[model samples]
Target: MLGVVPSSRAPNPFFWLEDTHTNTMEAIAMTIGHSTIPRMRVPALLKGNMIDVDLASLEGQWGMLCCLPRLEFCDAVFLNQFRRAVQKQGAALLGIQHPAHPFLAAHLPKAKILSIPLLTDSAQRIGRALGLSSETHLNQCQSFIFDPEGVVRNKLTHSFNWHCMTLLLGILKQCQ
Candidate 1:
């Protein structure tokens, strides 16, 4: 599936979408990050904790919404490179871990899991919201993109590929 539909509450995309065609291509690339995070709503799993990491504090900070396990696998090298990319730019990288794949911990430690215990409804809601209806082929998994202004910039329902990384990295470059 592609990215979620930019909520009506969010602003227009063209205005916020970076001009990735400029000569300074790298200068205007977007950073991969997280936004409109639903986890903020479910506090019971993490409620009233003033002594922990502040996910919201990462707002305005370059983000990368690293969705996990579409094909029951995640490349460690790719993940390392991804983290390295975002880290190099001093941007924040947030991992949107779902309940389906519980094995991400084997390789990732710093990743913050959103913990979506409920799967189907959340998956469909995200699919519709992101206008991923066209990507019927990628229905197997869910992952999307968002701009700094809360805009769902790009959507990916399929597994991570080299092209995906290039695109994600390009976004990260823009964020920097």
Candidate 2:
């Protein structure tokens, strides 16, 4: 059985399950820990208006981008909490979903009401760049924390659970 271990590097609270024999897992862990957010243009809805924006423009500000399969009413509630937390730390929070996800379309009104920016990744370009895309889980939920310089300071895969949320908040505190 694998056990999770926290990295000794202070202020970087990323953790990985120990599995010395799994080179694939080690490689992924390394890639995520060191990779920076890629530059790309995508359509986004902010404050009820749709706009095309370049992701690189987000540099110089602490930001958290959460990629989820779909947005539900409950998920919206959670996002609201996350929004407040991010804002409290002087960071921006964004949510991304595949444009084809029906749930997000259904919740567009509520999504627009939220203060955070909601992005529509029509071509999965962001997903592919972040290595979160797959044939089966094209819209898997994940959370990424970026420093003002645009470096990926921390990331949570398969997120949205209570544990992940707690970890995310902790990471935000340390990063800020």
Candidate 3:
């Protein structure tokens, strides 16, 4: 993807994923990693406010789907990066973690951090949504980018890296 700078040379709405020469703060800050993406239902609980973020609210969002095991979502670096990237996309940052894990706090004081739980589809007869049937899945933190229409536009299955995020950013810019 090529960066689209107008004749005025102002940074356009799009960011190129392949351009390593022109590195910006936005590009530098984005992350590519396999931290557990806590899958959460919309309108979740945070502090005392009613945070509603479900597929309904997330329908028009270009969400990054993350899959993480228990106790791994609390990584400070991963959480912050995920939050920031999602914030930039103006999309819902989702994670699907195993049940019985802690809850993700919007802001934890010191040691109180929660993991986002993924939604379970009872229609198992149709297919395996998480793409995991056995308990021991190797690729845990695979990230998939879904467009505003809920169609997956990009996929990062192995690891998160600068190139991966740049690819995601490129897709996001196209979406915008």
Task: Find the candidate with the highest TM-score and give its number.
Answer: 2
Model 3, 96-152: lDDT tens digits are 443334544445542234323233333332114434333424333455666666666
Ranking by lDDT, best first? 2, 3, 1
Candidate 1: segments with Cα more than 4 A from true spot: 1-35, 38-53, 70-74, 103-142, 147-152, 174-176
Report lDDT (Cα) of residue 124, candidate 3. Answer: 30
Ranking by TM-score: 2, 3, 1
The digit string of per-residue lDDT tens for model 1 on 1-176 reads 23323334445441122224542211112223343533232211211121233434545555555545442223434555566666677655544334344423333323222222212223434433434333323313344454454455554443355545665666546534
After best superposition, candidate 1 residue 85: deviation in angstroms? 1.2
The lowest-lDDT stretch of 10 consecutive residues in candidate 3 is: 25-34
What TM-score fits each model?
Answer: 0.44, 0.69, 0.48
In model 2, the runs with Cα more than 4 Å from the true position are 1-32, 98-103, 106-108, 135-140
TM-score for candidate 3: 0.48
Q: Superpose all Cα atoms of candidate 3 onto the true structure and report the RMSD in Å to 1 decimal.
A: 10.6
Estimate the TM-score for candidate 1: 0.44
Kindly give the stretch of ten consecutive residues in candidate 1 with the minimal lDDT sum.
42-51
Q: Which portions of model 3 miss their true places by more than 4 Å? A: 1-53, 73-77, 98-111, 114-127, 130-139, 160-176
Against the reference, the lDDT scores of all candidates come to 0.40, 0.66, 0.45
